[model samples]
Target: MLKGNREQELIELAQKMIQAKSYSGEEKQAAETIGEFCKANGFDDVIYDRYGNVIGIIKGNRPGPKVLFDGHIDTVPVSDESKWTQKPFAGEIVDGKLYGRGTSDMKGAVSAFTAAAKYFAEDTNRDFAGEILIAGVVHEECFEGIAAREISKNFKPDYVIIGEASQLNVKIGQRGRGEIVVETFGKPAHSANPEKGINAVYKMSKVINAIRDLVPTEHPVLGKGILELTDIKSAPYPGASVVPEYCRATYDRRLLVGETKESVIAPIRELLDKLMAEDSELKAKVSYAVGEEMCYTGNKIEGERFFPGWLYDQDEAWVQAVVKELNNAGFNPEITQYNFCTNGSHYAGEAGIKTLGIGPSRENLAHTVDEYIEIEQLTKVCECYYGVMKALLV
Candidate 1:
């Protein structure tokens, strides 16, 4: 239903969004731009929530199922700007691809969704009976699913469409993520008298080594659960002459289906217990990491860094509808799953909502230097989004 010249308009909007710096907790500018676009393009109700999430609503005359198209506006900070061949914020185009920080990770897909929603609003011939909500959420890159969880408190939809980079495939599920902190405690003493104090770093090193050899459970679709050491730090102000009193190592664990927080942490706790029994002085504890962040609106948001994994059966009505829509839009969409976590972890994972993903660009391209999205893929994604709206709402 999206006709001529609209494709260019969508690209322009994506360019504008990419031009803005929306790193993690700072998405106010991108949210405002998206809100203005929604209002200018005939969205029925456009408003910003207390946490700075922008939601555009289009209500129908009759009662029907509520459908949400969700996309996060925030992106990870650009590391090593000198590594990028193109300007990270310029929204440059080369060889039919648009280059920028958020192009593939997601601003391009968000723009496509906005364009499709505008098209649906402008057309007088089609009368949809269900409500359509397009949300440009915030803080997803820093804290996955926190903003989405907040949004669901107000707008709980029957179905959700996540606009994460899927290479235009239909993603039915993803592995969950958990941030775990392994802390080792010891007494501080002079560095020269090492035997007087237990070295917490040495105890932490053993735990890290043990975790590296862990064989996580594997699923047929979601693949294997993985544990990787992401960060390590020791306390005591850099330790000039004193032995470090505390050492903490952060582990990122990918959870398979049926793996709960308790189940995920059981192995690490067992390892700690074994080590403590071997040496009473080695005091180590394992606990889930807690995250605290402030939104651009100055609202404080906090949650445990545990995202449950989720999956929807291919035979489900929503999955079938998305498949039909993608085919109708002239795309050969393969059924797939996300390798990384997204807001789906909250919507479908925690809330048990029926959810699927379809968007432009490859999933692997996210967070890489010189990130870009193909223009053709962007246009196709717009058509696919419109097709989905028609399949579910009309």
Candidate 2:
């Protein structure tokens, strides 16, 4: 259980994080604060990766499996401050809730694991085995698994715990997210003589209709792999008396297990090919969207938007071990899965490591007007993380 002073420390750490306001690609202040906390605590060493990820290493006296507590430090921007009852960056505590921008989305989880690692290391005095690595990952809001690739390469942890919002439920899997781009091409001509030009918008319409007809794949547990048209734009903003010659559309794809990049676009490409065969003038292309962002450390991080989905059977040994310990610790966490994508997409979906997401708040609270996390949830999750370490760091 979390004690009074430890709980107070955890609350203060989360407050400082909320006050820092670290948006995507701008997490230096929050990162520095986390690093300072790790150093002031019992962490043996703290290092910033090339991408400005703050990693705190607490090694036990004996060697065993490496357990990583992963949480992203960046957050979505607060679009309107006036609409929020609580200031987004103030980190105010009201009626047992700590209000701020990144509290629920994830700075609260980061602070939990940070304080948990400190308490665990001090309580054991490094008498246990294995390693406890608490990482403050960056750029997760922009690229789900890109920076995590760096962390995996650096630590090669035996297991990963993603501190995504799970409302204290034990998440075993998720339907990953992918951004698919489709474009159409045609010849431009004067609107006065529209028949002389092939309107790209018309060409794109055919593709959109075909996509609408495509069936979404289904999973027994993770639900269907749904695809929806999100954005579409033509080359010319204002027709300008000319027929538009190019159209681009982006689709949000919810990925399921066993779906790959080639598999995802294959059906769309087949439809495009069939359309092209019927009409020789029709031209288009489809591919995954590539994302590139500048990190706060002045480093560049980029990746394809095809974050893979993953799942684990509830009967897996580690899964049961964690459930047993958390249950024994007075946390009745249900064995479940996240409804949205998370950093687990990289660790479990891409890197093929066993992963679990167990965090402190509701997912819907993220990116809202007045985002906040309960102090009770924060302290409970700190104890929960410690329980995970005790269960796995054998």
Candidate 3:
């Protein structure tokens, strides 16, 4: 067991991480803090992957499966810090809550797991089996699991633990996500004589209405495959008096297990095909959005917006053992799943590795102003992660 103010040390590290201002593209300071903490602690090795993710390792006495604890360092931008009661980066504690950006969205879990890994090593003295790897990942705020491909490459893990907020519950799976773009084409003409050209907005309106009538798919546990219209745009803003020639609509598509890029949008594609065949004036297409961003290390990270949904059987031996261990440790955590997308989209969804998420604080607290993780939550999550290490690293 770790001696002398271990909880205080965990709080200090979490505060440092919050103060670092690690937005999506910039995580250097937070990464450095993690690296230093790992080195100062009992980690056997610390490595920075190509995408600038910091990976800290604890090797056991004997050969066994490698278990990875993953948490992203990047946080969504605080659009207005002045609106918050506590300073967004101050990491202030008021009435037992540690307030700051990323505290709940996930820097807190990063700190918790890091401390747990350190403490587990100190307690066991390398007497256990297998290895524990903790990673502070980059660019997760922008791309859920894109940067994690690098971590997967560097450390081929037998299982992954994503520390997204779960309020101390064990997450078995999550609904994946995809950004689908639909566009309509038309001819631009003077507003006074609308018949002279096709108005793209009008064409898009028909497509949008048609989409509303289309039924979404469903899953037994994950709920519905929702395709909600998030936003729409038209070309030539402030057109003064011209018919818009083009229109684009972006839909936030929540996915189910076994969903693919092609499968996710096939319905929309077919709808477009039918519309085009019926009305020559209606021309449109649907595809998954692609995005790219620069990492703090200057490496480019990019991927298709499709992240597959995944679920693991609750009765699996390792998963059951973990649940039993937590229960025996006096933590009656509910066996649940994340409603939102997580880095599991990569590990479990894409890479086919087993993945689960369990962390401190409520999922609703993420990205909200005056975000916080209770001190009780912070410390318990650390202990829980230590419990997880004891359960899985054998």
Measured by TM-score, the strongest candidate is: 2
Q: In candidate 3, what are the lDDT values of residues 79-143, reduced to their tens digit?
A: 98789999999989999999999999899999999999988888888888899999999998888
- Using Cα atoms with residue i matched to residue i, what is each candidate's TM-score against the true structure? 0.96, 0.99, 0.98
Off by over 4 Å in 1: 1-3, 124-126
Evaluate model 1: give its TM-score. 0.96
- lDDT (tens digit, per residue) of candidate 1 on 1-394: 3456897799899999999899877999999889999988778889799879999988876779888999999999998999999999999999999999999989999999988888875673437788889999998887788889878889889889999988888999999999999999988899999999888898888878888877888899998888888999997868898888899999898988778899999998998899889988989999999989888899987889999898888888768877887787688898888889999999988898888999898887889999999998898888888888888887
State which candidate, 1 or 3, has the greater TM-score.
Answer: 3
Q: What are the RMSD figures for all models against the true structure?
A: 1.6, 0.9, 1.2
Give the poorly placed runs of model 2, Cα more than 4 Å off.
none
- Checking candidate 2 for backbone clashes, the offending pairs are none
Best-first order by lDDT:
2, 3, 1
Pairing residues by index, what is the TM-score of model 2?
0.99
